[model samples]
Target: MGRRKSQRKNVAMLDSDEDNSSVSSSSTARSDLMSVSGAGDVQVDKDSLLEQALDALYEKRGSTREKALAAIIEAFNTNLRHQFVEKKFATLLHQCLNSIKKGSSKEIALGCHAIGLLALTVGSGDHAREILEESVAPISHALKSSSDSLKTVSLLECLAVVTFVSATETEETERSMQIMWQLLHPKLGSNVVAVKTPAVVVTAVVSTWAFLLTTMDGCSLNSKDWQESISYFSTLLDKDERSVRISAGEALAVIFETGIEKLAAENKTTPDGSILEGNKYRQGYTHILGLKSKILNQVRSLSAEAGGKGSTKKDLNSQRNLFKDVLEFLEDGYIPDISMKIGGNSLHMSTWSELIQLNFLKHFLGGGFVKHMQDNELLHDVFGFTPKRKNILGVEHQMTSGEKRMFQSPNSVLNKARTQFLNKQRMLSKDRNVGHFAFGMGDEDSR
Candidate 1:
């Protein structure tokens, strides 16, 4: 009876069958799993399970493929699985790609997410570049063919993350951003009718685009191409959906912070594809400056916006705070210096780019955020965070903040999974303020 109970509990923790879009494990459930699997054999048991899941990916049944993919995602999320990735990265990546090619919607979603996690786990190297090179074509194909909202969201996120980590060139990032934008504003030929994108999907595309935008040099982007982007996002400010507005607001923040003067000077092309020189170039700069002024006014209004008929207090607060920061950036040329308390030390994000990357990865990693931030070397480099060092007297040394968070007691499973899981739930269920790291906002001068 106890074994069956454990099995049931594991299923509940790993399988979000009802949602089919999320795979999360509770630390308590993981602790239960550790007890049943035996503490000493945890690594061995997890390896066996991963091997089984990888093989199961080849089974002909769609449900079987989906379950296998889910199990792989859960395993990857629960731990870094560095050894498994090092040995079988190629095989694992190919199987996930095959699932994207042949499996059902859920399978495709899982495969996209699994490949993303794989890229992140591999970090920035030849392996990460390989994941980007191999996965982009299949992900692009899946996006064009499938209209499933859940699948589209996953594909967009995977594209953003893979490109962010692996694409080393400015052109590569631009290409990925173009693909994401196509979902929202497809080029309609003759009889091609545009598909009305769901508000949720719009939110994902805009936010993911902004995430990749953080990586590019503003001067490298074509002025003619991006000139209208500010206007487009300005229109999004009037969107009824709070999420969409929030995403547009964030995107605007990134755009304004990217140094528009440099972008304006890059404007050489006219709308007719002819080169702009002398007066035309100067006109382009002035036009961009005008757009900046218009946006500043819009942001000022949003910062002081009062609650409407059905606006929840929490969401209203989020919008007000975000816009206030944006307004401050526009007027005074000051970005918000936000600090998040992680254990004993605090993680600081003083730039728009840093904050966007942090929020995207926090959502992408979900419960695994704390674990990866603690152990993932790439993240450490990205955030410039250094974990506490241990001395030669390691046996007598006390545990660091990350270790204590992971293991409440010796021989016990990590506890951060539970805390981060609740935080993720709150983030998804309600647009609550950023938490878990005790995220708070402050002024640059104050810092």
Candidate 2:
């Protein structure tokens, strides 16, 4: 009776175990289904909202289209919508271009901004090429009509980015740079007074021009093409605006680093560091060195600049910091090495080109900078940065059941060997147990 009661108790426990397991399994299944459903819902909603914004771009009211563009820009800043871009790249590009073509100053600025973000989002290749090809004419037209500083800066930034990504030939890049340059220092034929551009516009033009200049082959640049640029930048250093001075300093640094330095290194120099006599590039080399001396003196004075009235300490400190770097690079040939931590990974920028590209994109992307740095493949390729892959919760990932099966498939040679080893162990254990049982039985019978 006791044995039967024990068996009944065991049966009850097994039934209870089965029931609990089934409930747990059902709960887990529901949770997983809900998670997947929620993700799908979010993606669908985002797409729907974007579609609405795109439709709004076609509405008759300018305000409505501007608001639509603001919505689109915010969406892009919030997340990289790769699927949406792949599907509607051309449509969005053309619509933004239309805004540039027909919209007011504010609308044109917003449109230029959106197009730049689009080029950055799409990155390099045929898409970037198409962006450049489609945008140049419209942007050039807008620039011709736009006297607004904000609008001009936006258009200039858009042009620089598209060219940076897609300009395969040196001439193509230089063409965009020339357009930016002409905004500040237009070539005049006689008796024409140069309209004084706003200081902010001047800074933007110089900075964007330098940004594109970073990508050009230093050797391919003719001495005549850039000789005037050095002098112009030197003159810009004396501008009253600190921002303009800083921009000019950076452009000078890039020229020294990318172009003149490369030229100097290629040519033979004396042990005293003077250019060898009779060298083909001797005249140009001498000219650059003379300009470099002037720039170095100006940079030194700026680096040690005393705070003056009307200049905010923030701007003052910024100018000092940049000029100090310029001074260091000019005197010692050491470019700035920067390391930034993003999503637990370190991104290092040791070259001026990388620094310029990063700063441009960062300023352009605004709040979206960190998100793109973490996940944008184009940025990764550009900087040679590989960010750690993260799941939705931003934690290290674990294998799913499917992944486990994939790695531990029974058909694999390693798995097959492991299975055979376990089977052999089981057989040996059974044999050993049988021998012990038989030995015990003999001892009992003998007793």
Which residue pairs does candidate 1 place in steric collision? none
Model 2 residue 172 lDDT?
82
Which lDDT tens digits does candidate 1 get at residues 241-334?
A: 8889899999987775553645544455655767777655656555666676567777778888887899999998988888887776665555
Model 1's TM-score against the true structure: 0.77
Model 2, span 180-268: residue lDDT tens? 87887677879977788999999999999988877776667776566788889999998899999988988887776556634454445
Q: For each candidate, give its TM-score against the true structure.
A: 0.77, 0.75
| All candidates: CA RMSD (Å) | 12.5, 24.1
The Cα local distance difference test for each model comes to: 0.69, 0.68
lDDT (C-alpha) at residue 313 in model 1: 90
| Model 2: lDDT of residue 275 | 63
